[model samples]
Target: MKLSQLKILDAIVSSQSLKQAAEKCHKTQPALTMAMQKLEQDIGFTLIDRSGYRLKLTPAGERFYKQAKRVLSGCDELDKISSTLALGYEPSICIAYEQLAGDQRISQLFGNVIQQFPRTQFKIVGGSRFQAVEKLAKGEVDIGIGPWFDIFHASGDFQSVLLKPIDVILVASPKILANGRTTLTSDELDDIPCLTLKPTELPFDDEKLSFAKGSQVVMVEELATLRSLLLQGVGWGLAAKHVCKTELENGDLVQIRLSDDEDQFQSELRAFRSNRNFYGPVASAIWQGLQELY
Candidate 1:
């Protein structure tokens, strides 16, 4: 089907009614219905079940709607790039990273994108990888930097580049450590009240906290809260060294450094995006900057 048809279909999926969808597309109800009919006939499948007062997509229709939206979004990106190129203007890139990775990762990754492409502007935000990827699917953001979360791979909406690896370490409040017990052998961490960042489903070691475990467990809402909770002496959280840099530097936090065993957990910063999304000038600039990082 045509790009306009796909966009109209996507709008119908969102508006949920013929009247609303037609209003959204600035067309009459009959014209909108004809468009839907043409699309369904071309695709050889029923796109929606019109039995309800509010429109709902059939199972096959829901699937088509998703794919169609991505195609339309890609077209929109191409239009934006073509227009910008004609006007001799540098494009903008919006980046979102898992807050768990912290600002250091963004600064190291996209910081130079700003300097290299003087005309382009970069906006960086922090959240969970899931949140970042969700925004990417909606074509709201250009690139995402974070760990390679398994769920994103499962969904097929993400492409990733692995950066540096790290361990998920359990960090205790210095208040508890002040009893001189902060110096625990690696074995003692098993029984500690660790603030886990991972969800209960990942294939993680039960006995050994990947120290990086909590990054996977942390939800969008809980990501920022974990850092504050650690500061409050609530419990130990498993996070990257960069994530807690300020606290560690200020002596408010410390890693449970293991002397006998080398930390082997391999969490890494990964750059990602949806398949249909375009990596225009702004995105390329960020990639260029990240390439120069140590």
Candidate 2:
């Protein structure tokens, strides 16, 4: 019937002892028992089964407790919303990123934003190319960071900037190299399987320069998974220089050079923000900070 009484019931159910519930509520046991009795009288039902040593909720009591917990949760969320609004901070913002967004750089840039606006909360979502772009176009996120392909569609309202380029080198397990040569011909590469990013959007083509276009290729959803496949000698694939630096250094994988220098591949990382969303003080700071990060 009352919010405080519901809270008491929640404490009792959670602690499983009336005395413990009284302690949690910071009240004397007798006063707590009296409040509970008054609640039951108002509701006209037995809310607890006291026949056992540990207090248990009766059938009806269980149902009431479940609804009471939801009410409490709603109350907490309302408090949070009110506090955030009072502080003049945005409720929440999401950043959708491609899996290749280097975690270290992202973290460092965000650290500066957090220092300036500690109350601002950030939600990061990472996925493959098409998925990240779609989330941004649909207004599911405020910003996006990923490899930018001209073919990926974006509306006129979206503003974008090209970040630093990420070098993508073809790599495979050293064991996969048959001739013990650092360079391989395109025809030779076409013979073995090459892990490739699965297309998720329309009018898909082998956009990036690749030698394994028509060769035995495995379509994958993420670079990390593709690296795993390459590590096991499952196939060769183009990977970001940052992601494969450790593996290449430790001899877990080796970069393959193409005999034709023209076949080199590189993708420019880009950031996008929808102009429709009002960039509040915090969002504006973040948006500007990201552009300067690159």
Candidate with the greatest lDDT versus the true structure: 2
Q: What TM-score would every model get versus the actual structure?
A: 0.65, 0.63
| Global lDDT of each candidate | 0.67, 0.77
lDDT for 100 (candidate 1): 61
Worst 10 residues of 2 by lDDT: 201-210
- List ranges where model 2 is wrong by over 4 Å: 1-87, 153-156, 202-211
| Model 2: pairs clashing at backbone N, Cα or C within 3 Å | none
lDDT of 1 by residue, 1-294 (tens): 787788788878888888888889999989988998998899899998999888999999888777877677668878877866775554666787767656565565555557767877667776652566566655678787766656566544676776666556657678756465655665555455565543432233133433533222333246667777777776666667767777888879877665655543556677777765556666766665665553
Decoy 1 TM-score against native: 0.65
Candidate 2 global lDDT: 0.77
Candidate 2 vs. true structure, TM-score? 0.63
